[model samples]
Target: MLIWERPEPSARASLSPLSRDRIVRAAIKLADADGLQAVSLRKVAAVLDAGPMRLYRYVDTKEELLDLMVDAVYGEIPAPPPEGDDWRAEVRSLVRGIRGAALRHEWFADLLGGRPHLGPAALGHLDATLTALRSAPGIGDDPDALMRALQAVNGYVLGAVRHEIVELRAERASGLTEHQWQAAAGPYLARAFAAGRYPALAHVVGNGSHQDPAEMFDAGLDVLLTGIAAGA
Candidate 1:
């Protein structure tokens, strides 16, 4: 008498309710977890338990997928602050919102720098931000100054978020808090200062009162908004 045993399953598995939206979402998750370098149609297909070619029905190429993914992220930013008044305040709120969203998705700021294409969601965010700026009491009907203000706000927020993201990543890599980062670097800073080659740097480093990024962001916002109002 012989006993029968179960055999292992085959390699081919049917794709689950796979749709274009789902695939794009999976691609975003992959990028978020493994960095954008790991994101490709084939990789996303693997995660979806589908064949790589299946994604072609939705996205023509990885570039298309990236555009879609960015739009999806932009959609997450809160809607522009309420209309009708306090437009400068509204603009500031929107600025903070964008920065917060970018921080949540670290790839965002990097994406903003490389490409110029605007997905629907990106356009919406832009329109909303511009609307806030235009409506600001001080922005005053002058198109050029309004444009400058928008550009300044966008640049400031992007820079702030990128800086914060880098600091967070470095902290994680070093396993140190911001205070700890300062503490660990303090001694080296002191030793370098003792040499006296860089008086300006030494004075600034010795001050030990430089604001952290969060504080810097607030101060920068105040100065930028104040200047925008003055320019208007």
Candidate 2:
């Protein structure tokens, strides 16, 4: 069973009393500063000024700690279960809420959609979203359509967020803005474009306007939502 499924143990009185929340928050801080690779039970215990084994009382393994961290992120994303009658708008709200949380916690995008999020906060957010979608015009009552819509939209979110984080981290690591990086690669791109075999790719790169990440995400989401809306 997941940690969330179990009742939380009370903190034992001591100089540094331990609770699951304290351990999870410390783990989150580690992940936020140095990414998921930095998180571990020992590290979290160290943050709490407690020995590693003490954390085992609340969290059994590293995986359980990660599960808690993901659920903590979900706690940050909450939207009203029902928002007027616009299913598209409602979904847009939920997606953007998720995006906002990811931006705040870059490592969050890495873990999200990577596993079954059965934690209370995750289930709460999901339940609210599906309930909102239940009011969607035509397909609301149809479980199959709802599931399809959920899967498609979530797939897009996972892929898009992963790409965005990759780019963002690449920029940070290389010490160059995306535009500067692109400019640095201009020669290689020019050579590729010169090859007549790649005409479509060349044309788009030559004439397509660059989009701010937020704008790109919004535009892509709308395109996707429009397709879903057609069935919606």
What are the Cα lDDT values of the candidates? 0.76, 0.85
Best by TM-score: 2
TM-score for all models, in order of appearance: 0.82, 0.93
> What's the distance in Å from true for residue 143, model 1?
2.9
Model 1 whole-model lDDT (C-alpha atoms): 0.76
Name the best candidate (by lDDT).
2
Q: lDDT tens string, model 2, 1-232?
A: 6566687877678999998889889999999999999999988888899999988889998988888899899998876555578777788888888888888899999887755699888888787767766676667679998888788888888888889988889999999998899889999989887877589888888999878888888899889878877777
Q: What's every prediction's RMSD, in angstroms?
A: 10.2, 1.8
Backbone clash pairs in model 1 (N, Cα, C under 3 Å; residues 3+ apart or in different chains), count:
0
Give residue 176's error in model 1 in angstroms. 3.2
Q: Write the per-residue lDDT of candidate 1 for residues 3-39, one digit (tens) a residue.
A: 0122222333454656656877898888788678889
